[model samples]
Each structure stands twice: as structure tokens, then as C-alpha cells.
Target: MPVMPVDRRTLLKAGGALAAVTIAGCTDSPSGHASPSAPPGPDVAVAPDWAGFGRGLDGRLYRPGGSGYAAAHQLFNPRFDSVQPGGVVKAASIADIRESVLFARKNRLTCVPKAGGHSYVGASSIANGLMVDIGNLRSMSYANGVLTVGAGARLYDVHAFLDRYGRSLPTGTCPTVGVAGLALGGGMGVHTRAYGLTGDRIMSMQVVTADGVFRPCSPTQNADLFWALRGGGGGNLGIVTSFRLSTIPGGKLGLFILKWTQSQAAAVIRGWQRFAREAPTSSWANLHLDARSDGTIAVRAVGVSTTGSATAAAAQLESFIGIRASSRSFSQKSHLEAVRFLGGGTSSPRTGFTAGSDVLRGPMDASTISALVGAVKARAGAGMTASAILDPLGGQAAKVPTGGSAWPWRSSLGVIQWYVGLAAHPTAASYNSARSWITSGHRAVAKASAGGYVNYVEPGRAIQSYYASSFARLKTVKRKYDPANVFHTPYSIS
Candidate 1:
């Protein structure tokens, strides 16, 4: 039931800190052959001039047979390798993005924006559609206390850049995750409690709407669109070129990692819930219940303290659990060091997994915890690797007013992510097992769950679950900005 003396390697993998991005690229056609054309739609008959389209752009375009096309279409998740786009434009500037959007609209082609290509459901990629790769738009600058970064910048690069000026922004720990996707879907991480969410720091944004019109969004400009962009899921309204956000001073941060046996899972969970809800805003922790391949559970707590000694933070956690950790480590680190440490030590890209989430309204009951534990154990017993990671949403995160942004989970206790590692070539049976386990997880927490997080979206669930009460307003925004539904995905507000 419990695993003792859990090592760091096992913990990182289980918690997805080491989840890498896979870049296998497209294999739809043989090498040297032309890319397959999408079946014609009812309204379109003539093919657009590919060479002519490429000539007018400042950025380069990649077709099926063009160099770099494969890499341009690659996504973080390997499962989407087969979904190849008809064309990929590496937009170099705002003008390039506007031109791409206008081109897609003129040709009535489906166009998807690719910031970091980390869409959990592969929404960033499209089958036989045009994919706009904004990876070349990365540009960063710091002025006064505001950090203006291109939407295409990855977390690690952003962190490293900010560290140079002794500044930091609230963002996810995954180094390869894109700033646009993470911030748009309501970023939650080590700095969340201490600094609120990444989006909360946003001062303004440069976005290219569905009409190919470039608009500046902020509290004072395009106010409605700005509110929607804060927590509104990406690929819904438009493509964000860059963002201007307020930054906090960077300095030494106290970090702690504590491990507990699964035998104390119940007490540790209950305690963590209370501690997360009551802890000082300067202190934050995430509880990870990771299932190893050997069919044992690894229980751990990893967090940071923006205020005092991490040793004190560790002791406070013990008091709540009513027991001491089996082992613990405490260290003080510079902002960049902490970012790398919490990011699982490396940013090497590789990927093969399926994940989803449930937002907890409060501490789960004993029965629900038992059910969750049982589901994990059962799935592991069947030879599937799984993990449940819970990140708290209290503190300043909840202080945002209801209408402040589209993110409706301000009052949530935390978000529980159900993650399952997939094989290089997963079988149907493996998918079935994973689906079953996730279903059980949803059923177990159904009573205490407010809904699901948009960032950890899954298939087959109602879109309303992500936005809750704000869904209606989001739809209204959608209608106003994208009445033609140009930027649409399976879970878009429309």
C-alpha cells in the first residue's frame, strides 16, 4: 500500500515535472512526396497559390515537401504526430500574423495558432488545416516594473530572461510550456499563492482577432476582450502576439520537499487541504500522490516559501499532518535556480501521456479519498502508471472578484490532475484502462468538485464545466469577437 524512502527520480516522473515533449513530426506521407491535400469543402473549389502566398509573407512558410515542415508541425504530445497541417507559417512579426489570418479567411481554411504546441488535446494542430507557428515571434523586454514578452516564449526562456533583471512572473513549472497557453488557461504554480496567477499580472496584450484586425487589450482598452483573455481558454478569441505583465522582484526563495508513506495518505491529504486553505499567502505547497510501476504509491509534498525559513514551513506542514515526513530536504535558492529545480531539473522535450483535471471546491471526504486511492492502486496493479497532483487555489488567487476574469475557479480549494503515462505505441487496452481510471476519479470527487480546469481539458466533457457560471458571458464575448467562429476548437466558448 505504501512505498518507503521514495527517491527524487520516481517523484519527478510521477508528478510530471519530467514530462518531456516528443518531436516525431508528421509521417503521413513518405519522404520526398508532396503533402496530401485536404478533401475539398462544399464552398471552396480552386486551390490557393501556395508559392504566391509564401512570397507576400515576411515569415517563411512550410509545405508538406518543404524543409522544416515536419518540425514546424510537431507538438508536445506524441499522440498528435499523425495530425499534420497542410501548411505551417513561422510568423516573424505582427504583420505576418495578420497576413496569415487574412489568408486563411480568404481561402476559408481552418487555421490554428501554435505558441509552444502543448495543447493537451492537440487543439493546437489541425488535420489538413493551416497551422500558424508563432515560435519566431519571441521578443522580451523589461521596463519599469512591467515585463513585455512575446506569446511564443517558453517558460524556461522567459524565466531565464527575467532572472537577468531580478524579476519573476507567476507561471507553470514546465519549462517547455508556452507563456500564451499557460497564462490564457489560468496558470497555477509555486508562485500562485504568493503572487496570484500569471494572468493577474497582465497589464495589456497585443492580439490579432478573427477579423485580422490588430487590437490592444487591457483594463482600459478593449476591456471586455481583456477580461476574457485572462482566463479564457486559448484558441477561442484570437492569437495573442505579446503580453505586458507586472513583475515581482526576484530573490532567494525557501524551498522544501517532503515525502510521506502512502499509509498516511488519508491524514496527509486531510491535513494538506486545511494547511493550503489556512497557510500564509507567502507559503505554498502541492500534494502529489504518484503511482509507481511496481504498484506502490509515492506520497510527497513540494513547495516554496516567499517569506521566512523553509525549515519552518516544513515543520508547520508536519503539525497539520499530525506526523513527521519520512524524509525531507530544505534549501534556499535564487529565483532561476528554484525555477529549474521545480521544473524537474531539465527542459528536454519528449511526450507520451493523457491527463485531465477536477477542481475541488473543498477538502474531500474520507470516502472520496479512499475511492481515489483505490482507483490509483487498481490502475497501477493493471500495469498502468498514474498520478494525482493537487495544487492549491486559495490565498490571493481567490481574492479576484467573480467578474474580474473568465476563470471561474477562484474559490476552488485546488485542482487535482489525473495523469497517465502512455507507451510509445499504446494499445487500445491501455487507453481503455486509462479512461476507466479517469472515470473513477471523476466519480470519486464528483461530490466535492466544482468543475474542471480548462488547461487540463479532456474529451467528452461538457464545455460548461471549465467556465461554470461564466460560460454564458464567454459565449457573448465569442459572438462579439468571432461571430464567424474562425478560432474554434472542440471546447471553445461557442
Candidate 2:
């Protein structure tokens, strides 16, 4: 869902990614969005045509050059840095979200809502259009083990809040990721195999449709929209205001990491194709290999299991990989600690990168494995880091029948991600090179992968890869919810 942002994915269910920063300098507003004492001059984008749009809301608005505009305008992926919104409405409440939708109709301008700003391909942004930022709409409550998360709540907020109650949800690793965005796209995480995806745990949501109406959706209420909301891509059907998610009790966890040299990488990967796919639902494993500038392939196998002790997890690891690991370590940690570690809590990870991933029915063929290793080494020689991962998707997640949700990829054994690094603020040369490498890497993986992950979206990809057989059904719901093409982006349900 959040793609669990970091230099690589933080390992979703660990929690998810961060917001991007820019060099543009602007003073922060002295007041928060919920405060009503704020001035109004800069709230309307300084246009007579925009004044009513601002007055119709209880939140603050930022024009291109308004105070806090620079801070609020940054997207998670800088690939679309050229696409600047005409204005950003920091919605203060559900009412503000409804007003923004109606305002978009009156102005005849495209309006996109942004929460947590982590769309992998900048899907939440639009060029010269209105952006309804729900950053200020964060207010939450938990009753009877159900967390009613605000549309604007981040993964960090959810984790911290749930930690207080010893409850957890399978989600992306990045802490700053928007809860609504992740669940909307059918979130996956280490806990997914056992507890199911973030969306799977969702009991209900508050959505603002194209008609500017706020309504509650669930299996029994607004059923069609609820079906679409479970796995329909974000900003596609309607603006979700709140999510009532069922949480699982969390406790101490056993974490395992096994590392091997390049010579052993293949054997480990070969074993991964078999064992990782079959690991216990309470146990999830991932394999990571990076092409280092030193021309060496760095391979590591990591996992978390809720069903066993550290020693038991280690023994399970031994059986998982028949070959002895060159280095192995195991630790006992609280769920929050382990989640943070997997999500990359210690880095300046919010930077630019090109990511291409694939959904596979099974493990990679022998040739694809060789090609992947070769590709990594080749990219490393080019001074670009090529990182790939084999993330398992079975366990409880596979129990949901195909078409049970809009995600429609229950047959997937796992996903393979190949991403090339670019500078936080990359040069044309660096960006182009990373794009080239990712393209080449993507092609190699496509030999086995039938589709791509929606959360880690790539530019210009067909919707079939992400939604598969669910695309047509998704389209029907999209048309019903947004017949005027109000909630749309480049790859939106069309």
C-alpha cells in the first residue's frame, strides 16, 4: 500500500514511507489549519475566481507563492516536480472536503485530494489544478478495538496510537505514509500473510463522492462504493474521509536476518522460490540483493514471525534456506521496534528513485534469477545502485478469493521490486540513467512477473498489471462514482 518507503520499500506491514522535501523556501503559517484566527488574503490564490473556493471551506488555502505553500506542495515522488497545483486546500474537516469538491465543479478545474503525499508516481498531484490536501483533517478515535483513522493520519500516527493499546495492522513500513492512501490500494505488509492486508482489516470508511456528498460505506451501506474502496486506486472513485479499521493484538516478535555472498545468492534465491512462498502465515520472509558500487552483490534474507521464539525462528530459517548463511542474526523485539527497524527509521530516506516491480505467480525461473543478479552487477558498475526484493504474499492474504476485493491478485505468490537510485534532487543525467536501468531491470523480471504493484506505481503502465481482472469492474464503479471524470489522473480507471 504505502510501498513502505525508504532507500527500498521499508517492508510493508512494518508500516510505510516519508514525505519529500524541496529547496523552495516559504515561511510556515503561524497557526495550524484547525485554528480560525488565520488571515484570508493568501488563502484564495489571489484570484477573484478563487475567492469563493476559499470562502466555501473552513480550512486554509495556499496559492503557488503563499506562505507554507512550498512545504505543503512537495510530492513524495519528485518525478512530477514540474506538475504544480494551482492551489492547495488544506481541508480542516469533512465539510471542508465536501466544499472543495463542489468548488472544483464551479471552477471547472481538476481537483485532486492528497493525504500523506506518498503516491509512488505522483498520482495525487496535478499540473495547474486544485489540490485538496487533507493534512489538517487528522482527528481520530478508537473504541472496541476499532481504530477510526482520519483520512490524513500517517502510518506513524496509527502505529504509535495502536502501540498504546497493543494493537497492530498489517501495513507498509514507512511511518509518514497516509493510512487512507495505503488501505485504498489494498496494503500489504509482513503481517499480511497472517493478518491480511491493511484494506482487509478495514471495516468501513467515510467517503466524499463526486457529487460532493459525504457518506459511510461498508458491506451493507453504499455497498458498491465500499467494494471499490477496498482496492480501487486512490483519488479514483471518491475522497475517503475516515477509515474504521479492525486491529490485531500485537506483542513481542522474533526477527531474523541472514546474509550471504554473491556466490551463494543464487542458491539462497532458488531456495527462496520454494520455502519463502510456503513459510507459515505468522512468518513472512523477504530477500534483498543490491548491486554495490564495488561490483559485488549484497544478499540478505529477512523475516518476522509472530508464532515463535527467536531460537525457533532461527531454526525455521535454517530449514527455509538449506544452505548455511554466511552471517545470521536473530533478535527479540516489540512489534513497534521491529516495524521501525524494517521501515528504515534511521535514514534520510525521502529522496528520488525509479522503481519497477512485478507480481509473480511463483518464484523466478533460473534464467530470470541470473539476469537479475547480472543486472544488479551491471548497474552497480554504472555507479547506480540496483536493488531488488522477493517479498512473499501468501499466508492469510491468499485466503481472500479472487474478485473478493478490487485488488484481484490473490494468486500472487509474492512481488519482485527492482528500483534504481537517483539523487534526492537529481540531475537530468542521473535521472535518465536510473530510468534506463529500471526499464532494463523491469524487462528482466517481466519474464516471470505478470503484473505490477499499484502502490509502487510506474509511469505509463497499463492498469491491467495492477488491477488485473478487476479493472473492468473497477471501471464500472469509477463511472458510477465519477461519471464526469472529476477524480482522475493519468492512469486512473478509464
lDDT of each: 0.74, 0.69
Alpha-carbon lDDT of model 1:
0.74
lDDT of 2 at 464: 70
RMSD of candidate 2 to true structure, Å: 7.0
Best by TM-score: 1
**TM-score of model 1 (CA atoms):** 0.91
Query: What is the lDDT for 82 in model 2?
Result: 54
RMSD of each: 5.7, 7.0
lDDT (Cα, tens digit) per residue for candidate 1, span 169-251: 88777777778887887877777888887778888899999899999998888989999998887788999999998998788
lDDT for each residue of candidate 2 in 82-119, tens digit (9 for 90 to 100): 56687888889888888888877555567687886766
The alpha-carbon lDDT assigned to residue 289 of candidate 2 equals 83
Pick by lDDT: which candidate is best? 1
Q: Could you tell me which 10 consecutive residues in candidate 2 have the lowest summed lDDT?
A: 23-32
